[model samples]
Target: MTSQLSADYKVDHFQKKATVVGLVGAAVFLFAAVAPYIFATDVTSAWIKLFYLISLATTWNLLAGYAGMVSVGQQAYIGLGAYGIFVFNDMGLDPYSSVLVASVAVGIIAFPISYVAFRLRGGYFAIGTWVIAEATRQIVIRFDSLGSGRGRSITTYTEDAIYRNLFTYWVALAIMGLAIVATFYLLRSRLGVALQSIRDNEVAAKSMGIKVSQTKRIVFVVAAMGAAAAGGIICLQGLGVASPNTIFGVNYSAFMIFMVLIGGIGTIEGPIIGAIIYFLMDYYFSQMGLWYMVVLGVLAILIMLFLPRGVWGEISHRFNFKVFPVGHQVQPLFPGIKLKKK
Candidate 1:
C-alpha cells in the first residue's frame, strides 16, 4: 500500500499595505514624540490630550474587542491613577515619577479586584464592575487626606509650567506608543489568538483547554493599568488636579465606548480612527452648547446605520486595507505551480 503526504501550508498575518502603513505610522509617531519641541504650547497640549485618549481607547478595545469583557468601570483605574499621582507627589516624588507609580499601583490593585469581578458574566458582569467602581469612588470621597470630596492638586511638581507641559506631553506620547506596540505584539502571539478565540466563543475555547478566566484576568489588569496611565497623564496635563468627580466620572467610559464603537470594535485601527473623529468633533463644535451633543449623536447614529462595522471596519471591508494585519492569509506553497495529492 502507498501512503500520501500532505503539502506544506504557509500563513501570512500581514498584508502588503501593512508595511507601508507601519512605516508611515512610525514616522508620524516620531514626529508626534518631538511635537513639544516643534509645535506651539497649545498645539502640544492638544496632542497630549489626543495621545491619552488614544491610550485609553486602545486598552478598552483590547478588553472589549479581543477579550469580550465589556467593562464600564475603567474610569475607576483612571481615577486611581490620577489620585495615585497626588499620593506620590505628597510623598515628595516628582510628578512624572508619580505617573509611573500611580499607574503600576492601579494595575496591581486590578488583579485582586478581578477575583470578585469575574464571578459574573455578560451584562451582569458589566453592572458588577460599575458597582465596584462606584463603591471605590464613594470610599475615596471620604478620605480627608485626598481632599475629601473637593479633590487635591499636585503642588510640589508645579515649579515650571512650560517644563511640566513638555514633560506631560512626552509621557502621553510614550504611553500611547507603548499601548499600540504592546497590543500589536499581543495580538500576534499565541496568547492573542486564544484571547480572540475566547471572545468569539467562550465555551468552544474553554473546551479546547484555553484558560478563559486566567487569560481574561490578565487582560483586565492590563486594561486597568493602561487606563490608569492615561489618567496620570491627564492629571498632569490639567496642571496636576486630581478631582474625583471629573476623573472618576462615568462620562469617561461613555466616551471610550463611543470612540470604540464609532471607529470599529474588533479591529486595531478602529479605536485610532474613532479617537481622531471624536477629538475633531469636540475641538470644532464644543462651543455650540447642546447642539454639539446633538451633532455627535446624529453622527454616531449615521455611522451605526450605514457603516455597522465602524468607519475603519467599513473602509477595510470595501478596500481590503489592513494597517495592522492580524488575520491570517493562506497561499499555495509553490507560486504558479499546483501540486496534486497522490
Candidate 2:
C-alpha cells in the first residue's frame, strides 16, 4: 500500500517569454529617455507628453482598476501638484527640486481628502470627488501669490531651449519610470492581494480581515502623489502655466479614463499601450481641430463597444499572454515524461 508522492512548488508572476520581452522593453525605453539630447525639441516634447500621460493613466488605473475606486476628479491632485511647483519655487527651490515638493504636497492633501471622498460610494463617490476638485480650484483661485485665475509660470531656470527641453524631458521620463516600477512592486506585495481582493468583493475582503479603508487610503495617497508628479512634469515641460482651469480641468480625468479604458483596466501594460495610441492620434490628427476631437471620441466609443475589456485585455484573454503578469498559473511540470517504478 506504499506509494510515492512528489510535488514541486512554483511561483512566478512573469512568464519566461514575458521576462525576455520586458528586458527588451526596458532597454528600448532607456534609450528613448536620452532621445531628447539626440533629437529635436518637438520630438522630445512629444516624448515628455507621452510619458506624463502614461504616468497619469497608470495611477488612475491603480485607483479605479485595482481599488475599485472610480474617481472622475483626479484633476484635483494634478492641479495641486502644479501649484506645489510654484510654492517650492517661491521658496527658492529649483524646478527639479520643486517636483518632489509638489508630489509630497499632493500626497498630504489627498490624506484628508480621502477621508471625505471615501464616505460616498458608487456614483455619489464620483461626484463627491469632482466637487472636491472644484472646491479646491475655487480656493486656489483666491490666492493672489498663485496668480489667482490668471495662472503662474516657472521662471526659475534661465537655460537655453536645448537645456530646458532636455532637463524637463528627462524628468518626465524619470517620473514615469518610477511610477511603473512602484506600481509593479506594490502589486507584487501582500498589500496588492488585499487591494485586488477588496476590488473584487469588498464585503468578502473585509470579512477575511482585510483593512479595506486603510488599504484604499494608501492607494489614494500614492495615486495622488503619482498624479501630482505627472502634473509637475507637465508644468515643467509646458514651461509652467498652472491655471486653475487647465491644470484642474476635467479633461485630464477624461484623458486618464480614456487611456485606461482603451488600453485595458486592471492590467499594467494596458495604460502604456493606451497612452501610445492616444499620443499617436493626437500628434497626427491634431491639425484637424474639432474633427480630431470627434474622431477620438468615436474611436473611444468603438473600443468600448467592441473591446469591452480593452484592447490589451482582449488580446491577453485570447492569447493568454502577459508581459507583466500578476496572477498565478499552474502547468504540468513534466509533460509526456514516463515515471520510473521503484
Candidate 3:
C-alpha cells in the first residue's frame, strides 16, 4: 500500500514539473517574438544592452547559482565569444555562426581549465579564474591573426545600413531569449534537480551517490557557453571589434558578479531583475559621471543589507512570485505528512 502511494506521489511530481515547463516555454517564446517590435527605438537602446547584460548574469547564475562554484573569471569565455565573431569574419563565415563556434570552443577549452580551477576551493578558486582570464588576455593580444591591443574590426553585415542595424538588434533579443529558455529547460530536467541537490548539501548529495564533481563540471561548461554567446551578441550590435582588455577585463567579471549579486544570487530570475536595475542606473549614472558609480555602490550595499536574497528573491519569498519560474517545485501531500517531491 505504501509503495503504491509513493508511485502516485511520483506521478504528481512529474505532472507539476510538466506544467511549469510548458508555461515557462510558452511565455518565453511569446516575449522573444514581441520584445524586438515593442522596444524598437534609439532611446530604448538601454533595453538592448540590458538584454545582453542579463544574458551574462544568467550565465554566472547558472554556475554560481546551481553548482555553488563562484567563479570570477567567466570573462575569458565572454572574450572568446567576442573574438569569435571576428575570427569567423576572417574565415568568411557568418558572424552569428561565430557565436556558436565561440561558445562551443569555450565549453571545450573550459574542461582543461576546470581541472586546474577545481584544484582550488573557495577564495582560491575565484583568484585562479582571474589568473586564467589575465593569461588569456595576454596570449590573445600577442596573436598576430588578431591585431594586437589595437583590436580587430568586425565587418558589419550591412556596412552600417538600416537592415543590418535591425538584424543586429534582433540578434541581441534572440540571444537573451535563448539563454532564458535554455536555463529553464535545464532547470526542470533531471540534471537541474541533481544540480540543486548538490548546491543545497554537497556531502549529503555525495553520500546518496551523486557525482558532485562531474555535475559541477557540466554546469561550468554550460555557464561558459552562455557567457560566450552573450559577448558575441553584444559585440554584434555595435559592429565593433573586441580587444583583449575589453572582452577579458577583470572589470567585466566584477560587473557580472555585481549584476548577479544584486539580482539575487542562486536564483535564475534574479539575474534578469538585477540587469534591469543595473542598466537603468548605468543609463542615468553614465550621464552623472563617476558619482553615479558611487551611488550604485551605495545601492548595492543597501540591497545587500536590506534584501540579501536580492530584489526578485525577496519578491519570491514575500509573495511566491516569479517572473522567471525555471525551477522544479514539489507540492505538499498532506497536512500531517512531510512534504517531498510529490
Candidate 4:
C-alpha cells in the first residue's frame, strides 16, 4: 500500500504582540498629537525637548548600533542644521521652513564629507569625525554673518507666544515621528540587512555581494539629515543658536551615546526608551550642577556592568518579543506532519 501526505508552512515578520503594541502606540501618538489642544502650552512645549532628544538618539543608534560606525562628530551636522536655519532665514524663508530646507542641504553636504570620513576605520574613523566637526565649527565661525562664534536669534519668527509654541511643538513632534518611521522602514529593508551584516562582519558582508561603502554612505547622509532636523528644532525652540560652541558642542555626542547605551543599542525601541530616561533625569537632576553629571556617569557604569545589552535589550532578550519585529520567523501550517514511504 501507498500513502500520500502534504505539509504547509508560513513566514511572518510581524507578530500578534507587535500588532497589539502598534495599535497602542498609535493611540499614544494620537494623544500626543492632540496634546496642544488638551494641555497647557507650557506642558506641551516641554515635549519639544524630548522629541529632539529622541530624534538625536535614534539616528545615533542607527549609525553606531546597526552600521558599526561609532562617530562622535554628529554634532557637525547638528551645528550645520542649526546654522542652515540662519542662512535660509536670512534668504527670506520662515524659520520653520528653514528647518526642512536646512536638513536637505545638510544631507547633500554629508555625501562628500562621508568620503573623507570613510578613509579610516575603527577608532581612527571616530577621531576623524571629531576632527571634521571641529574644522566645520572653525569654518562656520569665520563667517561673520553667522555670529562669528557669538550667537544669533531668529528675527523672522511668529510674534504670538501660544501659537509659536504650538507650531514649534508640532514641528518637533513631526520630526520625531518621521525619524522613527523612516528608521523602522529602513531597517526592515534589504539595505538594513546589509548594514547589520556589515556591522557584524564587513569582509563577510562584502563576500556576500553587499555594497558596503554605498550602503554606509546612504546611512551616513540619512543620519546627517536626521541630526540636522533635530538641530533645527533645537534652534527653533530656543528662538536661535545661543552660541556656536554650545550648538556644536561634543556634549551632544555624549548625550547620544548615553541614550543609545542606556536604552539598548541596535534596536529601534531602545533609543526612545533611553531618551525618555535621560530626559527625566536631566529634568529633575540638572539643578544639582556637577552632581547631575556624576549621577549620569554612575548610572551608565551600572547599566554597562549589569544590563550589558541595555535596558530594552535585556528585556527583549528575556521576553523574546519585539515591538518593531523587523526579523522574520517561519512556522509550519501543520504542526506535526510526516510523509509515509511505501
Candidate 5:
C-alpha cells in the first residue's frame, strides 16, 4: 500500500509540473501573437522576431537535443520550406495552408537524401549535410520563378484577408504547441527510450536489436518536417515573402545551435531557456549593429568552456533540480532493504 501510494504521489507531481509548464507556455505564446496590436509598432516587430527565435530553437532542440542528430545544413530546408510556400500561393492556394504542405514535402524529400548522407559518419556527415544545403540553395538560385537570389512574395492570399492575421497567429502557435506536445509524448513512449538508447550508444543499441539506420532516418525526417513547418509559418507571418538568403542563411543555423547549447542540450527546458536569453540579447544589442553576431559567438564559446553540460544540465546535476523532470526515482535503497534513520 505504501509503495503504491508513493508511486501515485510521483505521478501526481509530474502531472502538476507539466500542467504548469503548459499553461506558462500557452500564456507566453498568447502574448506574443497579440503583442503587435497592444504595443508600439517597433515593440511589436521585436516580439514577432522573438517568435522566429523560439521556433528555430524548438526545431533545433527536436533534432540535436532529442534525436541526437546534428546537421549544419538545416537552413537548406528552412530556405526550401520558405520558398516552397510562395510557389503554392502563386498557384492560388492560401498561403497559410501551404505551410503544412511545405513541411510534409520537406520531410518526404529529406528521407531518401538521409540515406545518402547517413553513409558518412561524424565530421564527414556534418559536412555532407552542409554540402547538400548549399547545392539546394544553388538550385533555387537558378530558378527565376523563385526570384533567383532575390526575394519573391505572394501578392494576396487566395482565402482573402478575412481574419488572415488571426489565422497566421493561430497557425504559428499551433505549430509550436504541436512540436512541444508531440516531442514530449514521443519521449514518453518506447520510441523515446529507443532514441535515448541511440543517443547513449548507437552500436550497443544496434547490437540489442534496435534498427539504427531506420530510427535515425525517421528522426531526421521528423526534425526536418518540424523545422520546415517553422520556416513556412515564419514566411507566412512575413506576408508570404520568402527570401532565400535570410531564411537559409548560415546564421540561422548558428543561432539555433547556440540557443540549444546555452539552454541545455538533451533537455526540453534548455533550448527554450537559451532562446529567451538570445531574444533578450537581440532586443538590446540589435541597434549596436553586427557586433551582436560577435557577441553570440563569444557567448557560445564561453558557455561551452565553462558550463559544458549547459545551464539546465549543470543546475540539474549540481542541485538535482528537475523543473522539466521526466525520469523516475526510488525511495528505498533496495527492493526489500530498509533501515531506520533514527
Candidate 6:
C-alpha cells in the first residue's frame, strides 16, 4: 500500500512559467533588435551602455551569488577582452568579429587563472582575484603594440557613423541576451543544483559527491568570458581603449557588486532589476559629480540595511512567484491521497 501510494507523488520544476517568460523575452528582443530603425542613434547608443551593464551585473551575480565565489578581479577579463579586440582587429578581423574572438580567448586564459585563484578561500579568494587583475593590467601595459600605458583606437572599423552605431547596438543587445539566456538555462541544469549546493556549504556539497572545484572552475571561466564580451563591446563602442586603467578599473567590479547586491543576490531576476536601477541613477545623477557617488553609496547602504535580500528578493519572498523557477516542487498526483506508515 505504501509503495503504491508513493507513485502518486512527483517532483516538478515549473517549465510553463519559464516558457512564458522566454516567449515574452524573445518578443522584446525582436523589438529591441530593430530599435535603431525606430529611435535616434543617440537614443539607441545609450541602450548599448545599459545592455552591457546588465551583462556585467548578470555574470557577476552568477559567479558570486549562485556559485558563492566573490571575485573582485573580473575586470582582469574585461581588460583582456578590451585588449583582445585590438590584437585581433590588428590581425585583420573587424571589431565586431574581434569581440567574439576576444571572448573565447579570454575564456581560455581564465581556465589557468582559475587554478591560481581556487587556492584561496573566503576573503583570501576575493583578494587573490584582485591581485590577479592588477597583475594582468601590469602585464598588458608592457606591450607597446597594445598601447603600453597609453590607449589605442580601432583603425579598421567602418567609417559610417550610422551603420557603426547600429552594428554596435545590435552586438550589445546580443551579448546582453546571450548572458540572460545562458544564465537561465544554466541554472535549470544539473550543474545549477550543484552550484547552489556549493554556495550553501562547500564541504557539505563535497560530502554529497559534488565536484565543487570543477563546478566553480566552469562558472569562473564562463563569468570571465561574459565579462570579456562586455569589455569588448566597451572598446568597440568607444572605437578604442583610451587607457588600460579605465578598462581594467576596479570600479567596474564595484559597480557589478552594487548591481548584484541591490537587485537581490542569488536570483537571476535580481541582477537585471538592479542593473536597471543603477543605470537610471547613473544616467540622471552623473552630472552631479561627487554628490552623485555619495547618493549611490547612501542608497546602496539603505537598501542593504532595509531590503537585505534586495528588491526582487524581497518581492519574490512575499509574492512567492519566480519568473525563472529553477527549484523543484513536490506535489501529489491525487489530492486526497494519504500514505499510511508501515
- lDDT: which candidate is best? 6
Output the worst ten-in-a-row residue range by lDDT, candidate 1.
2-11
Error of 4 at 126 (Å): 0.9
Weakest 10 consecutive residues of candidate 2 by summed lDDT: 2-11
List the lowest-lDDT window of 10 residues for candidate 6: 333-342
Output the TM-score of candidate 4. Answer: 0.94
Q: How close is candidate 6 to the true structure, as a TM-score?
A: 0.97
Candidate 4 or 3, higher TM-score: 4
Better of 3 and 6 by TM-score: 6
For candidate 1, what is the total of clashing residue pairs? 0
C-alpha RMSD of candidate 6: 2.6
Q: Please give the lDDT score for candidate 2.
A: 0.87
Residue-level lDDT of model 2, residues 7-76, one tens digit each, is: 4333555657557766887897789876866788888888889999999999999999999999999998
> What TM-score does structure 3 among the candidates reach?
0.89
Instruction: Give candidate 3 regions above 4 Å deviation.
Output: 7-40, 323-342
Index of the highest-TM-score prediction: 6
Alpha-carbon TM-score of each model against the true structure: 0.93, 0.92, 0.89, 0.94, 0.85, 0.97
- Model 2 residue 176 lDDT score: 91
lDDT of each: 0.88, 0.87, 0.78, 0.92, 0.76, 0.94
Candidate 5, residues 1-119, lDDT tens digits: the string is 34555543332236567778778877976776676467655555454456556677777786777667788888888887888787777777777788888888899989988998899
Backbone N/Cα/C clashes per model:
0, 0, 0, 0, 0, 0
Deviation from native of the Cα of residue 293 in model 6, angstroms:
0.6
Which pairs of residues clash in candidate 3, taking residues 3 or more apart in a chain or in different chains?
Answer: none
Misplaced by over 4 Å in model 6 are 1-6, 337-342
Per-residue lDDT tens digits of candidate 3, residues 33-73?
A: 56556765564455568778988888889888888888999
